[model samples]
Target: MSRTFFTSDHHFGHKNIIDFESRPFSGVEEMNAAMIESWNSVVAKEDKVFHLGDFSFLNRDKTRAIVERLHGYKVLILGNHDRGRSRGWWLDAGFDEVSEHPIVYQGFFFLSHEPMYMNKHMPYVNVHGHIHGQKYEGKSYFNVSVEHWEYKPVPFEQIRDSVAADEEQ
Candidate 1:
C-alpha cells in the first residue's frame, strides 16, 4: 500500500549548510546524494511525502531537477527559506501542494514547517520541523527534520504510533 511520510530541511545544493548545521558530509553534493538515496530507500514511488519545508536552496531549474529525481507525491509546507518563488513554481517543480500554514492531519496531529505549541486542551500532537538537530522532549511535539531522522522521510504511521506512546506515558 502507498504510505505517507514526513521530513524537512533537505537544503539541496546549499554548500554552506554543511558547516552551519555541522552535517557530517564532506560537501554539499555528497550530502544531497546521501539524502536522496536515503529518501528513495524508504519511500516508494507512490508514497505521499509531506515535506515540512526548506526543501531546496539551488537555483530554480536545479531545484526542479532535484525534485524530479525524488520519489513520492510531495506536498510542501512552506518554510522561511522557501522564498523567491511563486506557488506555481513549486507546483511546476513537482510538489502536489504547498501551504503557508500548518495543517491538522487525521484529527490527531498538527503538521507544520515550524514547531508549534500544543496545550492539553488542543487534543492533538504537533508534528513539525525546522529546529534541525534539537527537539522538545516530554511534550506533545515531534521534530521530523532530516538532521534528526537520518536524512530520510519518516513514515506518518511511525510518528503516530510514537505520539500514541508518548500520550500514554
Candidate 2:
C-alpha cells in the first residue's frame, strides 16, 4: 500500500537560495543531494507526495531529471514561482497532477502553498508551506517546508501525530 507525504521549497539548482536562506550545505549540489537522499530515506517508491510548491529553480530538462529521480506518485500544488507556467510542462516533468489552489484532502485538512489564513472557527486543520522555518502558533496550522523538516518530506504519521497533539491542546 502507498503512504502519503508532504513537503515544499526544495529549490533545487538554485544556488542563491543557500545564501538567501542561509542553508547549511556547502553549495547547490550538496543541498540538492542531501534533500534527495533525505527524501528517499523515508519515502518509498509507492508513496504519494503532495508537493506544496516552489519545488525547483531548475530549467525544463533539469526539472524533468530531478523529478524522475524522486520516489513517489507526485502531485503538485502550484505556488507563486510555479504560476504562469504551462501545466503540461510540469506534467511532462513527472508530476501526476497539478492544482493551483488549496485543496481539502480526505475531508480533513486544508492544503496550500502559502500558510493559509484562518480564524478559530475553521473546521479542518491547514497543512501548508512557503513560510520556510517561520512558526505558526496555532495548532490548526502545520507547515511542511523543507526548512522546517530538515530538507525531507514529512511522513503522514508525523502530520497525523502533530494534528493529534494540536487537538489535545
The prediction achieving the highest TM-score against the true structure is 2
Across 1-169, the per-residue lDDT of candidate 1 in tens digits comes to 9999999999999899898889989998899899999999999999999999899988778888888889999999888898567777788887889887888898878898888877667777888888998888755888998998889999988998887887788
Score every model by TM-score: 0.95, 0.96
Which regions of candidate 1 fall more than 4 Å away from where they truly are?
Answer: none
Candidate 2, which ten residues in sequence have the lowest lDDT sum? 79-88
Q: Residue by residue across 1-169, what tens digits does model 2's lDDT show?
A: 8899999988889899888788999998899889999999988999999999988888889899889999999999998788767788889878999998888988988889998878888867888988887878887788998988888899878898988887887
Against the true structure, candidate 2 has what lDDT?
0.88
Q: Model 1 residue 27 lDDT?
A: 93
True-vs-predicted CA distance for residue 109, candidate 1, Å: 1.1
Clashes within 3 Å, all models in order:
0, 0
Per-model root-mean-square deviation over C-alphas: 1.1, 1.0
True-structure Cα RMSD, model 2 = 1.0
Clashing pairs in 1: none
